[model samples]
Every structure is written in C-alpha cells, then in structure tokens.
Target chain A: MTAILLISSALFCAGVYGLLSQRHAVGVLIAIELMINAANLLLVGFGWRTGGAFGQSFALFTMAIAVAEVVVGLALILLMYRSRGDVQVDQATELAQ
Target chain B: MNPLISAALVALGLPAALALLLAVVPKLRRTGKPAALLSILGSLLALSAAGWLAATWLHDPKQVLDLTTSWLPQSGKSMSQVGVHLDGISVSMLLVVAIVASCVQLFSLGYLSDEPAPALGRYYAYQSLFLFSMNLLVLAPDLMQLFLGWELVGATSYLLIGFWFTRPAAGKAALKAFVVTKFADSGLILALITLVAWTGSFSWNATLPAGGAEWLALFLFIAVMGKSAQFPLHIWLPDAMQGPTPVSALLHAATMVAAGVYLIVRADPIFAAAPHVRLFMTDLGAITALFAALIAMVQTDIKKVLAYSTCSQLGYMISGLGAGSLMGGYFHLTTHAFFKALLFLAAGAVIHAVHSNELSDMGGLWRKLKFTTVAFVIGSLSLAGLPGLSGFYSKDLILEAVHESGNPLALGLLMATAGLTAFYMTRTVVKAFFGKPSHAAEHAHGPGPSMTIPLLILLVPAIGLGWLAGPMSKLYGRSYAFHLDTIGMVTIALGLGGIALGWLIYGMGLLQALPRAFAPIARIANGSTVDDLWALSYSKLGMGLARAIAWFDRYIIDGLMNFLGWLFMWSGQRVRTLQTGNVQDYLYAVFGAAALIALWGGWR
Candidate 1:
C-alpha cells in the first residue's frame, strides 16, 4: 500500500508540472490522464487492502470519470490539429498582453 | 351684479379681449384699420363706463363700490382677492386714464397709419394692453393686484418703446428704461415682502406700526422715484422719445408717469405715519424739479424738451403730495394729463410732416400746419401756467401747498422750477414754430381730421379743466376754493416773465448773442457728464464683475475636475494589463492559486 501511494503522488506531481509548463496540447492531455489513472490506482489499492465493497465502487466511479475526460481531451486535440495543422498550446495565445 | 362691477368688467375686460384678438387672429392682424377701430371702440367703452361710475360716485360721496372674490381659493393657509375699489380717487383716475387712452388711440389712426399693416397692428395691440394695465392699476383694491398692474404696465412700456426695433437706439433705450425701473421694482418687492411678514396681509388698508411703516414707505418712495423718472432715474425718459409720438403721449406724459404720484397718494397714510419720509420726498422732488427743468432748458431735440418737462411736472406733483396735500397733487395730475397729451399729439403731427425731431429742423411750421400750431400754443400756454388755464389752477395749488408747509427752501426751488418750465417750453415753441422756413419744415403740412379732432377735443380740457378743480377738490375731501392769493400772483408774474424772456431771446432774436454768454452754463446743463457716470456704473462695472466670475469658474472650478479625470485614466491603464484573455495564462493562474491555497491549508 505504501509503495502504491508513493507512485500515485509522483504521477500527480508530474501532471501538475506538465499543466503549467508544457507547450504542446497532446502532452498536456496525456499528463492529465496520468493524474487520473494515479488516483484510480490509489483507490483500488486502498479498497483491496481494507476489504470494503464501498471503496471498490468508488474506484469504479473514478474509472468512469477518467474515461469521459480522455474522450473530451482527444476531441479538443483533433480540433486544434485541424485548425492550425499543429496541436501546440503556445500558438493559441491570441489574448496575449 | 353691481353696476360698479359691470363698469370694471368693461374697463378691464374689453381691452384685454381686444389685445388677445389682435394678437391671435391673423385676419385682424392683417389690416391696420380694423385694429385701430377695435382699439378705439374698446377705449370708448371703457371711457363711458368710467363716466357712468363717476356719475354714480357724485350722487353718493360715502359709497364705496368694492367687489372682491378670492384669487387663490384652493390655498388652505391664505387667500388673496383680485377686485376693484371704486372710490372717488379711483373714479377720477379711471376717468383721466380712459380719456387720455381714447384720445391717443384716435390719434394713432393718423400717426401710425402710414406704416405697414403688421406694424400698425402691433402698435394698436400694445396700446390696448397698456390701457388695460393702466385702468387695472387705478381700480385695484389690494397692493398685490396693484403690483400685477404695475409690472404689466412696465412690460407694455418696454414693448411700445422698442416698437421700432429696427432702430438700435430705440432698442437700447427700451432696455435701459426696463433695467432702471426694475432696479426700483426690487425695492417695491422687498417692501411687499416686509409688509407681508409684519402684518400677514397684502392689503393697502393694513395699518402698520410706526417703525415698520416708515421702512415700507422709504422702499415704496424709492420705487416711485424710478417710475416717475425722478433725479438720477430721469435719464431714461429723454431717451424714451425714440418711441412713437402717440406712445409718448399715452405712457410718458399722460398716464404712466402719473402712476407714481397716484401710488404715493393711495398710500398717503403710510407716508404720513413717517414724517421724515414725507420731508425726504419733498427734498427729492424739489431737487428733481429744479435739475430736470435746467436740463430741459438746454435740450436741442423737440421731444427731449417735452420729456424733461414731464419729469419736472411730475416732480411738482410729488412735492405737492410730500408737502401734505394729496388733493393738490392729484389735481395737478388731472390737469397735466390733458395738456401734456395735447402737446405730445400735436408735436407728433409736426414731427410726422417735417420728418425730424430737431427743433432746429422745425422752424416756420406754424403757417403750413395751422391747426397743429394753434393746438400746440394752447398746450404750451397751459404748461407755462398762465392765468385761467388748467395748469395755472393746479400749479398754483401745488405752490400754495408747499408754501403752507413752511419749507421755504422747497417752495423757492419749486417756484423757480415753474419759471424754468415756462422758459424752456416757450423757447421750444419759438424755435420750432415761429422762425424763418427751415429746410426740414419747408414742406410741413397739416395732419388729417383723425389727428386734428383729438387735439380739438383735448383743447376744451386744456383751456377749461381748471374750473373743475374746486369740484374735484371737494370730491377728494378737501374744501373747494377758487381764489388767487399772493403766491398765485407771484407764480403768474414769474411764469409771464419767463415767456417774455424766451420771446426776447428766440422769437424776437434779441438774444441771438446770448448763447455765447450762456455757453459755460449750457455745457453743464447739457448733461453729458451725468449720462457718462450712469453708463459707467451700471454697464461697465456689471461687465467687469461678470468677467471675473467667468474666469474663476474656468480655472479653479474646472481644474479639480480635470485632475480627477486624468488620475482615473492613468490607474485604469495600469490595471488593463491583467485582463490578458489567453486561456493558457488563466489556467496557469488558477492552478498556481490552488497550489498556494493547499499549502496554506496544510500549514493551518
């Protein structure tokens, strides 16, 4: 259980760093999915160790939310690629000072 | 309905209705003849009503025909009445006002007939309005209603004076007259306020205590001085001759100037309650009488001479009232109205034919304009107060009143002023009627019967109204008398001596060289310096104050507002950079804020 928690924390830290510093749209979406999967791994590990049906049901709910997130992220990336011929976040700064 | 009320309705309502019709109806306004006829008929109806009221008053001396109805019936706190009081004094004033008004309207048929239709219509409209206001003033029972009539007359005077608005001089003169009188009107307004506050009433019958009454009397006297053209306010009258001749006859000579005397007589109890105010009025009247007569002696314009004489004669009436003889003052007002109106209308005819107002341009017109010359001579003789004329009876009475008051200084000044009146009028007549044919007067001709008939009618009063003095005095509650005493003889001698002197100088050319001797005195009497002083104080000083106020508003008041606006713009520009609409930057800001909040929550 301790090892699983360490792995999930590291994934969440990487996701946050990517959200703030990544210049590519696809990289940002992959990082977001990584954070969601890390949360799902933590929930499933806790459920198996505690031996409760409630924790397992909550882990299932997290998996469903992750699925919806990936679906919306891929659609946005496809639109960006079609409009600009490249899915880069830096090129979308039309409101720059 | 009372007959008195019916008289008042005719006197007040007829002219107002006619004025409204002439103003609103395009058909009436398109023709001069119909307007003149309407004005004449309205005045004639009013005159008959006044005649009927006078007859009724004669039958019963104690009969006070008063009609009052609430003016502001909806007022929960106070109610004022708008009505008429038909007493002996009011009846007499009504009679004089109507007679003069009708005569002037009749004469306007010839005087203004040559003008275009619209201008003639406008003149008759204003004339009707003036008649209504004057009659209302005479008949008003309360001070408030009297003030309404007062202000209306002043407005009508302005409109009539500036009737020929194409002339810049006429417009300026109108404005000057209005401003000067309005300044005095402020004093009247203040007096009304004080009186109302002290007694809670605006009726002339409200008896005030001694101290309050004195202040009110002083304020009222100041207004009277302005309206009557006394002393410093006398400057506007000579310039007011820029109006048509009929207007001069109606407003300046016959009725409007007399209003001041009428007011003081109406408010005699207030003035009597303060002896000092009466004495002050006497001194002011005497000084104005002397100075205005002096000015009249030197004027070159024909109308200016008559205008100054009007002022001087009004001074005599005021002095009579001031010296404690209301009977004598109002008596002179009645007689003066006839002769002065006659003089002005006759002069209008001469000026119309000669096409000039200059005495120098009016020589040798007597033969060509025979009827007008005869009428003018009757007016001039009466004005000089010759024995047996109407002016003789009234002027003699005023002098006797001053003498009886025991104020030797006022008496002497008034007597000398009377002599000066004779001198100046005789000089004017001699220069404008009896000399060799002037270039301007060479083609002068007689006016039509529309003008000559009014002069003929006024001649009866000018020559014979003095006999009515005894009966009129009795009506005013004074004893009737027709005897001539020492003062009367001296005044007559002085008057005759003045006419003889003027005859020697101008009529006989005995004093053709006298102008050289009188040059130094003439310079002061011409009054250019007095005119300059008044213009400087009233106009230039007012302009200077206005400019200073404008400067302060522009700099100090505007500067603070401008600085606040600049500061707002500067701070707004600095805050605008934070509104960068990039989605990535907003998301980064939100995530950074969330991280900081989580760290703070853990520490707590």
Candidate 2:
C-alpha cells in the first residue's frame, strides 16, 4: 500500500506539470484527469494501509464525481470546439482582454 | 385571527397569485390588464388590512409576530434556517409597498390602455412580479430571505425598465440598470457570506462580534450605495427614464429605488452597532442628495428631471436612516413615494397628451390638462419641501435627526440642500407647465379619468401628510424630545421665494431684473453642461457593462467547457483511427489495450 502511494505521488506530480506546461487545451484537460486519478489511487492505497473503509468510500465517491465532471467537461469542450476550431489554449484568445 | 399569516399572505402571496391567474386564464385575455389593475386593487385592500394589523401590533408594543418553519434542520450547525419576524420596520415598508404597487397598477391602466391587449397583460405580469419581490423584501426575516427578495426586486426593475425590448435604447437601459445594481449586489452577497461564516447564522436577531458588525456594515453600505443610486453608481437612474412612463413611475421613481433604504432600515441593529457604517450612510446620503438635485436642475427631459429628483429624494431617505433616525428615514420614504409617484404618473399623463418626454418640446400644458397640471404642482410643492406638504415633514425630520446625529456640518449642508431642492423643483415646474404652448402642447389635452384620478388620490397625502408628524414623532422618536418647530418655515419661505422668482423670470418674464449672483448662476444652472452630463448618463457610458458581462461569459464561464471538447476530439481522433471501418481492427485494438492493462497491473 505504501509503495502504491509513493508511485502515485510521482504520477501526480508529472500530471500536474503536464497540465500547466501544455499549450493545447486537450493535453491540459487530459493531464488534469491524470492528476485526479493519481490522487484517487493514493486514496485507495491509504485506505488499504489504514484499514479504513471510510477512506475507500470517499475514494469511490470521488471517482463518481470525476465521471460526472468528465461528462460535463466533454459537452462544454464540444461547444467550444464548434465555436472555435483550434484546440490550442493560446489560440482561444477570444476571451483575452 | 392569525394576523401574521394574513398580513404576510396579503403582502407576498396576493400579487403572486394574481400574476398566476393572469397567466392561466384564456377567456380573460381581453381583460388581462384590468385583471392586472384589479390584482393591484387586491393588493390595496390587502395592504390596508396589513397596515391595520400592523397598526394594532404597534398599538400593543408587547405583541410580536413570528412565523418560523424548518429550513435545513438535518444539516446540523451548518444548516440554514430563517424566521419571519414582523415589527414596526416591516409594517412601515409593507405599507409603502402596498400603496405604491396599487398606484403603479392604476397608473399603468391608463398608460397601457392604448397598447395592444397582450402587451398590457405582460406589463401587469411584470408589475405583479415587481410587487411580489418588493413585498418579500419588506417581510424578509433573515439575510438569506432578504437577499433573495432584494435580487428579485432588482431583476424586476431591469425587466420593466427595458420592457420595450424592441427598442435598442430601452434594452440598453435595462441591461445598464441591472449590471450597475449587480455590482452592488455582489458586495451585499459577499457581506452576507462573511456574516454567515463568522456568526453561523444569517439573521438580524443574531448579533455579530463588533469587528464583524463593522465589516458587514461596510459591505451593506456599499450595496445600499449602489441600490439607492448614491454617488458614482447613480449613473443608471436618469437613463432608466427610457422605459414607459408608468414603469418609470413604478420602478425608477418610486418603490424600487426605496428598496435600498428599506434594506438598511431593516438591518438597523447591524448598522447601529457599526458607528463607521452609520457615518458612511450619512455622508453618502448628504452628498448624493445635493449632487442629484444639482443634476435635476439641468435636465430638459421632464422625466429625466423627475428621475434625478427621485435619486435626490432617495438620497435624503438614505441619509435619514443613516443619521440614526431610522424612523425619520422611514417617514421620508413613505412621503417620498407618495409625491414621487404622483409626479411621475402626472408626468406620464402629460407625456401621453403631448407625445414627448422632452420638456423643451412641451409648454402651457396647464391650459389643456388642468388636473394633470394641478397634480403636478402639488407634487412639485411636496418635492420642493413646502410647509403644508408631505415633503416638508419628512425633510425636516431628517434635518432634526441630523441635528441629533452630533454632526452639525452635515445637518447644515442638508438644510442648505433643502433650499437648493426648492430652487430646482420650481425650475422644473416653470419650464414644463407654466409657459406659452410649445409645439407639442399646442394640440395637447387632458388624459382620461383613469389617469387623473390616481394623481388626485396621491395629493391626499402630498398636501397634508406632514400634519401627522407631531404624533408620529412621539411614536417613533421617544429618545429625542421632538418638537415641530418653525425652522422649516424659513426653508418654506425661501422655497416660495424661489418659486416666485422662477415664476417671474421664467414664468412671468422677470429674468431681466435678477441680480448677477443669481443670474449667471441660474443661467448656467439651466445650461448645456447639465444636459451633456444627463446625455452621457442616459447613454449609460455606451454599453460598457454588457460588453464586459458577455466577455466574462465567453471566457471565464465557458473556458472549461471548451477545454474538454478539445480533449475529446483529440482522443476520439486517435481512438477512431484504429476503428478504420474494419471489425478486425476494432477487436485487435481492444485486445491490445486489455493485454497492456494486464501487463501494467502485473508489473505494479
């Protein structure tokens, strides 16, 4: 369980860095999902180590929320993509002051 | 007799039910507006009943009515709850709302009679909705309910102001009205959130720590500042005159503008505890009163002039409440509604006859529209703070309260402003009504009884409502040994003098003999700079707020949605490439992904 937690932390760090540094909006979104999943895996690992069922339920609930988020996020992304063709975040300068 | 339920039902429920009736009935389609008018009549009876009940409660000071129901009981300490507590403050506001709502409906009947039947129905719906929100605002027991009601009133005003949606200018005015007040509403919501976090309850009865009270007061003041159109944020009211004149009578000139003062008065205990906030209210009130009055002096559009006067008058009430004379503020609010609505509806009648809002395009309306001219003059006299009029009582009470405020300078300047108010209001009367017929009024005539009757009814209070002051002072001002003194008589003399001077120069052609100090000042007082400012304010800085809001919606509000779409397309393109319109390729890709997942799981 501790080993799983240690591995997931590295994945989470990589995911966050990718999320911020990427210029393409799609890459950024994928990286965010990766980061969230990594955190979820760490929660499951902690649940195993602590022998706490509460932690496991929390992790499961978090996963459900993430699924809802993805569905909403994808719908919105489709709207944006149709409005403006390029997926690059910098090209989405329609909102910029 | 459950007076609490009955009053609350009348105050809040009747308008909503009436609006619903208008919506559902088909055979009543032609009767839509009369139904709307009757709905407000229902409000009048309900309001009279509520006022009687409230008066009874006031008579028996020990009687307090509480209406409570569980809101969020299961959420423990974090759960939200609300209590509906009816007292003198609610009674006062409820009475004001009932009176103004009824008049607006009566005024709308004539205003809308010429319109297509369907639009009139919609107009009544808007009116009912407005009354609903305002009534709720008065009876709101806690910060949460209060804000909900507050927001609803603000929204109704915007809708009604911009009710002529086909006109670009009307739509623009409505949006400007909403965004500007919303700027203040945000501050208000923030203050409520802060109070909830710190005190664990969003209610007036729940006292906050001293520091919290001060912070909350500052936030509430910012909101009242915007809502009541005090300094800087006031740019919306003059432009708001673009709506139909009945709407202008209802929202811009009367009850909607008073909601801010009602809010501060409703939250008096919170304000009273914060000395700084109370002081802020006083200063804002004084400055706005003087400033808006100055602008009103220059407005050539008759409605625009009245709009600025409404702003100035509202400023007076705000300051009165701020001066620790909550009762004085409330009194001024009541009287201001009577006269302001009278003025606006009278103005509406004049505009209906002449087919214009521009005073420059109207003159000698009195020869034609006699009752309108009379009603307008009475309204003007009240507005000018004449001695036997409602304005004098309320204005003097504010002054006396300011005297009690321990701020001699504020009181003095406010008194001087009384003189200024008289001068400008008299100017409006001279330019609009008491002149040779301009082109518009050349063919003008009096409006119908439906219009003239409401104007006359308002005069009941406008002419002598101030006489109630001595007893009211006793009822409301126990802390101060109040006396109705002759200090206002001096102001009255000056007001009459201003009217006479205006009558001579503008009305009777005595501009030829005026002293230079009053001359160049009076000349510039009626100059183009004032119109230019009114023009700028009326145009609402050319749609800056709407552009900003739309920009926010496109960017911050919609950004996340766009990002996800991109992610889906990118992944879908990669995944779909493998499908290749071939069943073999799909199976192979799926097997490959499963094998890779199993390998990764084994390694981990």
TM-score computed on alpha carbons, candidate 2: 0.73
Ten contiguous residues minimizing lDDT sum, candidate 1 chain B: B72-81
Candidate 2: clashing pairs of residues: A76-B561, A77-B561, A77-B565, A78-B565, B504-B510
Candidate 2 ranges beyond 4 A from true positions: A1-97, B24-31, B72-74, B77-84, B470-490, B512-604
lDDT, candidate 1, at B27: 82
Candidate 1: C-alpha RMSD to true structure equals 3.6
For model 2, residues B1-604, the per-residue Cα lDDT tens digits are: 4766676766777787776777677445456667666676777876786678667755754455767565655446534555455766676567767776777788778877788777777778778878888877777777777888788988988888887889999998888788888988888998888887787777866778757788888898888877888876787788788889988887777788888888887787788888887887788788777777766666778998898788788878878888898778878987888898899999999899889988887887789888888999989989888877889878888887787888766676677677777777777787788777898889987787778777877889787767765545543535433356765666677677767776776777767555445545545544345446755664676566777778888986787689789899999888666545432344346555766898899999
Least well predicted 10-residue stretch by lDDT in candidate 2 chain B: B579-588
TM-score of chain B of each: 0.94, 0.84
lDDT for each residue of candidate 1 in B1-604, tens digit (9 for 90 to 100): 8978888789988998999999898689779888878889999999999888888877765677788776754446444567888888889899899999999999999988789988888888998999989988898887767777888898999999999999999999899888888888887888778877777767767879758888988998888988899887777788889999999998999999888898888887788887788888887888888888888888889888899899899999988988998988899999999999999999999999998898989988888999999999999999999999999999989899899988899999999988888988899999888989799788887899989989998999999999988678767676778888999999999999999989999888897776567666767766566777889986679888888888878877887788789899989887776656556677778888988999999999
DockQ of each: 0.36, 0.01
